[model samples]
Target: MTTYLNSLDYARYLDETDELRHFRAEFLVPERDGQPLTYLCGNSLGLQPRRARQALERELMSWQQRGVEGWFEGDAPWLSYHRSCQEPLARLVGARPAEVCPMNNLTVNLHLMLTTFYRPTGTRTKILTLAGDFPSDQYALETHVRSRGLDPAEVLVEVPLRAGEFHWREADLLQVLDQQADTLALVVMSGLHYYNGQVLPMQALAQKARALGIPVGFDLAHAVGNVPLHLHHWDVDFAVWCSYKYLNAGPGGVAGLFVHEKHHKAQAPRLAGWWGYDEARRFEMTQGFVPMPGAAGWQLSTPAILPLAVHRAALGLFEEAGGMERLREKSLRLTGYLEFLLQDINQRYGAPITLMTPPRAEERGCQLSWLVRAEGKVLFDYLGQRGIVGDWREPNCIRLAPAPLYNTFEEVWRVGEALDTFYAASRPRYPF
Candidate 1:
């Protein structure tokens, strides 16, 4: 059982005994008022790993010393540099190394994945997704459908939420897939819901789509490093994600994709670039295209070396924490703690802060998006003024993600304390 506590000493004690406590020093935390800022915004942008600078410097020196020769010569050659990051990246998402590759940014990867999977034919022309998915994804699907000379209004099926509901009911989604089975070309599943931080049922959703002969893909931007995912075992057709958020790869770092091994051999309809050509004779100045085997074949151009370097530095820490399973174990506890504290405040002050994220631990990640019953931004701005950095989504949700990789129990306690202070000051004047 979790020890419910409202004291700072209790929070510190939990931190004192935490096995992952030492890993905190590995990240560069932001500060305010001459103190470490209580940063719970990993869902928006993750804190940088300390080793990222050293990793960048190493590559910068190699570039300075070797110039173009850096591609073929050096301890870490740039030509096959993307190869080194495969294992850690694969481990994070639960895929074989052959199934994953670091490539373009999030929306770009989403478009690439759709280029092959979102093939619309005679009757089966629509792409199915939830109503409030990240806007970029909605836009990607919109443009992708438009590119085929097909009308997006007819091809894109966004299921609306139930009456007064904040969460998407899986039953409602499954029914839409079944109802539109004949016309649905693809199902785009978000591994984690971005706004509310709810982790969707990916495996079950894949099974549903597969039963109806509809191919499914995932935009795992929020799910990649924040939650445990098994894309291969779930038989996920294709998936894409950005590394900058929970993976802590810095801003606009390299993203990755997973192509099920089954689709590797002449199956995917790739928009081929020279980088995606077969590695054996890539530099032959060849005219005909021979795609590289497996997920690496999706590469469109030479990678941005600095971002890949920074990503590897971040992955190194995940490996040190003994992979995602261990990190997830701690994540469950930290997020749960935040939920508990928020609930406690909800009852104490009679403040109607309803958690927008899923109630079940299995259905959520580190983030807890709370819907303030009234005047939400007031509480959000209050927290920010107190050096607690959380994200504010419009219409009333404040998202606080106490990332297990760097966030501690004590920081979580301070959030609760800050809320209490906010309530104490604002309750009477604001007429809550």
Candidate 2:
């Protein structure tokens, strides 16, 4: 473990870090006044991988050199482009190659999956989700329910968190599943709570729901690549995740989906497109939809290859750097270090700045949500000005995510110090 003498000495500590030192060169880390921005925002947009430029340039060159033939000729043929991403992505999500498909953006894939899996009929028409899921997920569920002739008010149920808690406990979630077993068609929750970075116990939840014959899905927008997952082994019915966050793909990169093998042949609702047609006869242009066997069947349109190329480039880094296990080992230590530093800062302030993210290493990811007692906005902006790039949630929470792939222990310490300084300097005068 790397040790730091003071906050400013973190830079030297970063230099000494074995894993930390190598990955900095892999990304285009933005600089603030000649110093690299302490980028704690990988929970939003990950840093661009140095290899993406080469990957995209290869495609651009192929397009110029081969035109449409680029589909078949290049080092990476566009015809089988998405396949290149499958294994790496599957490894990240803990699914088999056949069970995972890299395609469509996050919401699009959600809607596509919902079309097949969220078949509501008779009593089993309701969709259950967490109360504060990502806005896009909520919209997709509500819209899908409405489209199926079920009122969102009646068919879409949101399981609320405990009054003072930041996330839903597994027991409470299971109880809801038990209560709604008859009516619940689908239960979708963020695999990791975005705002608080809680990693839901997906295996336990999935097992419980499956035993009751309920299909459970997960929106892994904040979880994938940030934490280790085993969607296949966990028997997750299906899952959707974006690549831009911890996956380090470029903005709006292609998203990924996982469908357990058990559902590969199951008769279910699905929205079809040509890309999902059996690859053997995809060019046959058949009138009837003969879908691919597994998760690939959920693909709706011919994927935008440019974004996929970028994703492949980023995924290669994950593959080369040993895998999620190695990344996660560092993540636990780095995040724990940040938590320790933050607690020190809270003590120094003599003000209540509580951490909303769970304390256990297993229950959380790299992100930490700190709830400032007062004037959160002022403190957030002040941290921004200081080049500590954390994000603020709507009310009083600030999220600092030190991604393991590219972030260092030193950056964690710097962010904590910046928060401490901001809290001390931002106290407003009382008009006595």
Reference-based TM-score of each model: 0.98, 0.95
Q: 10-87, model 2: which lDDT tens digit per residue? A: 545554865645877899999977988889999999999998988888889999999999988967888778889889
Against the reference, the lDDT scores of all candidates come to: 0.90, 0.85
Error of 2 at 363 (Å): 0.7
Q: Candidate 1, residue 44: CA error in Å?
A: 0.9
lDDT by residue for model 1 over 206-247, one digit each (tens)?
999988888999999999899999988999999999988999
Q: Per-residue error at 82 for model 1, in Å?
A: 0.6
- List residue ranges in candidate 2 displaced over 4 A: 1-11, 426-432
Q: What TM-score does candidate 1 get on C-alpha atoms?
A: 0.98
Each prediction's number of clashing residue pairs = 0, 1
Error of 2 at 4 (Å): 8.5
lDDT of 2 at 96: 92
